[model samples]
Target chain A: MKRDLALLLGILLALLAALLLWALHATLALEPGPRLAELASARLEQTGVSNPVTAVLLNYRAYDTLLELAVLLAALLGIWSLGPAPAGYQRSGPALAALVDWIVPLAILAGGYMLWVGGHAPGGAFQAGALLGAAGVILRLSGEPSAGLPGEPAQRWLVVLGAGVFALVGGGLLASGFGFLTYPPGQAKWLILLIESAATVAIGVTLTAAYVGGRPGSGTAHNGTGQSRTVQR
Target chain B: MADLLILPVLVPLLGGLLATALPVRSALVGTLAALATSLSGLSITLLVWLHGDLGTVLGGWGVPLGIGLSADGLSAALLAMASLVALAISIYAGSYFAGSAQARHFWPLWLLLWSALNGVFLAADLFNLYVMLELLGLSAAALGALTGKREAIAANLRYLLVGLLGSLTYLLGVALLYTAYGTLDIGLLGERLGPTPIAATALALMVSGLALKTALFPLHFWLPPAHANAPAPVSAALSALVVKASFYLILRLWTELFAPITDIGAATLLGLLGAGAVLWGSWRALRAQRLKLLAAYSTVAQIGYLFLFFPLLASLPPGTARDDLFAACVLMALTHGFAKAGFFLAAGLVQQKAGHDRISELGGVAQRMPATTFSIALAGSALVGLPPSGSFIGKWVLMRGAFETGQWWWLPVTVLGTLLAAAYVFRVLSRAFGLEPTPLQFVTNARTEIPALLLAFASVALLGLAAGPVWAVLGFGAAPA
Candidate 1:
């Protein structure tokens, strides 16, 4: 009886505390301050980029993209080193292949739209590329002969090339007495767009590679072929 | 300039995505990931120190509409510590699981962890911080599940569930703040926040949510089982990094926002619970059969020491008292980070050699694995706050600070925690001395023992090194307590 009474008291105290906090919040009349919706449009004008979000992702926050590249490349290399195992010997079913036939094109279209519209919309390189990568995985899982990642050499070159181009372009700007990754005053738009395009390819390929663990043509691929698991971006 | 803050987080994330794509040589991918992350950490630490606070004008839109990443001194320090431990763990793990099947994905998960940790530290905006924290929780759970045992899977699932609940509560707090205040940037919130009822409620919600995430006893149901069952490197990272990050935020919020009200009565409540955790955890650790469980329980006890600072510091009025108070907290953080990481690594070596971490059967194990044994002992010494270790100095400062401020109760709590630590350390060490009547034989490879020894030695020498620049670095620039 004592224990039960104590428990009830504890519960009541908790309820009282909750009610008190709620009352405090109600009396204070809190609200979200400001939403910088106009700044996105304004930034597009300043950077001369059609999509402010894209400009931000590829230009303003390019370092994040850079580190992301490092992660993908690292995963790819790890999978590459461990390839040619018996685990990569599974065959995909015909039904899955048929599904990929339709889904792949749609995925590509959506990915492209996301990249293009990211300047003003909610989607960007990361989301679009991830969706495209999902399509690639679907094709591979569905038994498409070339559904998987490309050869190691080609994949490595592609991954490096994206970072290479960004770095090289940025390096030139550095040489011009600005700084690393500084887009020239008037050319920020095109430079930003160009970087996003490369990132799209790199991001798409990277996500796909992480899932597939290398391309189909690249000697028995190793990585991603574990006891099948679903992946998310 | 602000954008650079986000790069450290993004690079590993992108790399994690690409690591899945890499064919063959998956370990190499993980190695590269570690390299990239370490580089990012080092550069960011240097940059932040050289310049000042770093933040991102995310999405070409500043805070409110778009997210942002920021690194102040606190974030930089935590980032540096996380990077160092991750680098060490990666090196040790490289050879530890060299030919294992999961090595391919190990690097990917690790990179994911790296990104999550960095993101959590750099996140300037509230929503982003919540997202990063969730990512960290999920990835940590996934990493724990990698061992592929029924126990590991179950523990990880439980951890995930509890972690999600914590995150949900924290998210709700964020919503409340958004509903109450206008901004999410911690700095902006600090400036805009008045001592209003709504603001106070928001603070309460946020603190409680973070406290739950940090697992301050009563709420720490998910920590021990999950931490004990995980693989060595994973356990080390989780204990030394993941939980600490949440606490880091709590500390930040306290120093930044709640300093005024904390002196009233709320801080005392937290300290009281902390005192309980110290006793409960130490008592459990002394009685645990498994080395891993012992270590996990020790973490509970160690965490108690961190909370003691709040009440102790708040009791002090302004001036040098505050400076010493904050310094003690920082020292405590640094020492715990190193010592716990070393302890976990040592425990890993023991488990690998014996095939089980059962303490009773570990007799005469020290004969073969002296390095690992030494490492464990040194780490244990630090954990116990024994003389000549970083932990000793940290505890001494804290004790003195407490006494100077008239918080005499902390003395008993600290002393009791120390005694319990000593008892447990001796329990492990005495068993290692071949005194057990039913002693079981053991042998361990040198490869595993070296990293453990290095980390342990580092913990021991940490205090000595601090006399130089590291000591100066302690209070280089800060608002004191």
Candidate 2:
């Protein structure tokens, strides 16, 4: 009976939503116009990037992107707070190690290429960062724990690099009489590249660290239970 | 001055980044950063209040393209309230988590949550609000689950998932809105909006999603568990500021973006659900076994009172009477923010002394902490809508508005909720007056006790007697026909 009632309620809600959607379809101007696309393209030259999407993400709506990085950082902080990173993956067999050795550097090179091409093409910080993170994943799979990542102290700084640099550059712009995230007219391209480089590195570290799933020392403990530190009572 | 609007968001974010990087010095850095951030936020609010609304398209990109941040009377007032409460929470947290291993984790997340709260209040772009909402949810859930207890982690996992679903639904609505209007700016959409099926669907998706976040009745199932299971400071912030951010968005949407499309029938439906929340939440709160659980349920009830204003807002024509009701709604929400934070802080201390918050066994602990007990009493009176409290003023205006609109049925519900609130508050306070030897001094630790007392005192003394400024700050003049 309880399940039936819930089902009934769900159905009723769905029907209500459908009806509302139907009403909106009938009365609203539901057009698929290229509103932002057109606007971005028009303002693309001034925004200091060739790709309209890049212009939008890095310039026109950079504030959202800035906060997005913060969101990523916040998630990592939450995970770290829970416990230390688990111990490194078990040592891979020699065959897998050979494969990882070949794959990882190629991934890094590809990530660098993606970062460089992001200014005028379909590559940017996030894409490049994802490539770098993939390399870390390969290292982890091959049982090279730490996933090619640094220790806890260094990892902390690496994780913050994206948001820290973004904020610093934003503040720098504001100090120079430009609005926050507003690159000066002629300097937009270089600044964008500089910010993207930092973001790519930060994102790569954060993704890999998250995959590592605990503080650096967590995996070192032979027992399943990680060390728990208690603050002063 | 338009540029100052970004400071509230930037300062805490920078602080969070700094704390995240410098793990060894996070506590000291986090505290100083929180203090600086709150002071700067308060100053920005004052600047806007004195100078009128300030808005700027970020990166100098015009509307329809760039995201914008605006600080009007509404945003400014809430920003000021949030900052003050956050400052108190930061100070309380400093001592609460002192020397704990988790302290490093707490500061960065707390600062991030602070930044998100400011971001939500100040965001003028729809998609921007989505990003801010997601940030707020992640940080809040993480903070809420800091205790590492089985129940705390489980409850927060559910919270995190629920928050994700709500944001995704809200994002769908934003997508629909952008498709229809070609812009995500609130003002631009408001100017272009018309009553249509797509608009209706957008409104439903957005409002329902926000209602879930706000923990409105029927959708509020996730709230109490999450609120009650969190650490005390986290509980305070969750109840006082985080949940209210969602409701603020709902109010902003209903009055501004959806005004043209909002129907009286829809408003009445919301009012009915609110009534259900008030009655049901109060009853649950009254019967709750744990102190924090009771506080959490009371949060549910208080949120209902805020929603009761919607029907009145829809019924009344645009004029002073409507404006008065609007201001009163904001006043009630602000009062609850202060009152609830004070109650939770005091409750935390009491629990610390007793080692548990089982209300029936709190007698010995209650008698010892006279200052903490006093804080609860004051905050409780405000919660119960006793006279000389801001909630008293808020409830008065609410009831009067109901009468004027001839919606007299709401009065009985309001009265019953108030009485139930009073009963539960006194039930807890009754423990304090027992025959155990009481402390001769009113205060025990000024560091901890002062923040709670000051918040409770402001809810009653400052807000109740000096509410004229709220009206002026909202830019509403004396009532006009």
True A-B contacts kept by model 1: 0.13
Query: For model 2, how does the per-residue alpha-carbon lDDT over B1-481 read when each residue is reduced to its tens digit?
Result: 6877788999999999889888779889999999999998899788876888889888888787888899887888788889999899889888888888778889999999999999999999999999999999999999999998989999999999999999988998887887677889998988888896677788989998999898999888999999999988899999999999999999999998999999778998899889989988999999999999999999999999998989989999998899999999999999999999999999999888889999888876888788899999999999999978889988999999999999888899899999999999988888766667766754388878889888888888877888887787788985221
TM-score of every candidate: 0.79, 0.96
lDDT, residue B99, model 2: 80
RMSD of each: 6.2, 3.3
lDDT over C-alpha atoms for residue A30 of model 2? 47
What is the per-residue lDDT of model 1 for residues B1-481, given as tens digits with 9 covering 90 to 100?
5545655665676566555546356577777778878888878877876786777545444555445667776787778777777887888788777787666557667777788788888876776677667767777777777676788888888987887777776776676666555566776777766776665666676777777777787677778889999889888888888888888888888777655445537788888878887888898999999998998898888888888888877777766666566666766666677778888988888787778888888886664677788888998898898877767776887888777878888899899999999999899988776764533544555556676666667666854345222333433533222
Best by DockQ: 2
- Fraction of true interface contacts that also occur in model 2: 0.84
Model 2 chain A lowest lDDT segment of ten: A224-233
TM-score of chain A, model number 2: 0.86
Top candidate, metric lDDT: 2
